[model samples]
Target: MTGARMRVALSARGVEVDDGAGGVLAPWGDVDRVTAFALGTVRYVSFDLVNGHSVEVDDGAPEWDEMVAALPAHVDGGVDDLPAALAALAHDDPVLVVGAPVLPR
Candidate 1:
């Protein structure tokens, strides 16, 4: 199977450089570092019905912030990998928890 690829861009502050013409400043003041990576296929699955009953679960859905928080800390490769990354989060059974809150006595 063909693996997915991704690119990342990083920026920072540094000293300036002079241009060749009469010590003039360079057109582009700062520079950015870009990197690429190849990631294998990732998948995530969620079973809405547990023990043959529909249960309220946290599947990283409903809101963009919640979904983003559920994703892996480090994600790279092409945009296609986004689905796979999300899938990975879904498959991550450890992080999944019941959304219900405990009632006070």
Candidate 2:
């Protein structure tokens, strides 16, 4: 069966900070902050079907409820349906993608 999947890249850059000893800056210092980025394909499941319903597995899937709950109350079954579903899933789990980047504030 076809399903939603995304191929993403997670990148992190260290932040520069003071040495506190009042010494010269170095190339690699303590990492106070971090920046990340996610780049890749974002495929979503096709919500539209000719008399077909989406199937979801519950066993071995702890976040099933959250994922389903994320769906919109009323699905239009249009081109944006998939995107809406993906957005819902993202809301439930920010890092839903396998290689989704995690950025630090």
Candidate 3:
């Protein structure tokens, strides 16, 4: 089966105070999850991958909610769908992509 996936970098208008250990933190703000397909024009908070940092964001946005919607639906699809799905991501959002070994069936 065909599949897709993509995640753009998102920018934050908020402050990321450095942790005592020199790490960074995102205290949750607005968020938007945009893929190639948007049920409708979308505008909201965004997140992305950068050293596996964590942040908070609103879930009301189309992208964010859509991501959740796709989870159960993409049970047998490939990873390619991610790119198109994440196209709407805020070009500056920070996110982490952790992958594991999938045993061959």
Q: Pick the candidate with the highest lDDT.
A: 3
Report, for every candidate in turn, its global Cα lDDT versus the true structure.
Answer: 0.26, 0.27, 0.32
C-alpha RMSD by candidate, in order = 20.1, 18.3, 14.5
Those runs of model 3 whose alpha carbons end farther than 4 Å from true positions after fitting are: 1-52, 55-57, 72-105
| Selected candidate, larger lDDT, 2 vs 3 | 3
Candidate 3 to truth, TM: 0.20
Q: Estimate, for each residue in 12-95, the C-alpha lDDT of model 1 and write its tens digit.
A: 211112222322111112211111122333322221222332211122323323333432222222434444444555332343
Residue 90 of model 1, lDDT score: 32
- Candidate 2: the clashing residue pairs are none
TM-scores of the candidates in the order shown: 0.16, 0.18, 0.20
Give a tens-digit lDDT track for model 3, residues 12-104: 322233323453443223212221222244323223324353333333432355444443232223444453444545545444231211212
Would you list the rank order by lDDT, best first? 3, 2, 1
Badly placed stretches (over 4 Å) of model 1 are 1-40, 52-93, 98-105
lDDT (C-alpha) at residue 41 in model 3 = 41
Q: Where in model 2 is the C-alpha error above 4 Å? A: 1-48, 51-54, 73-105
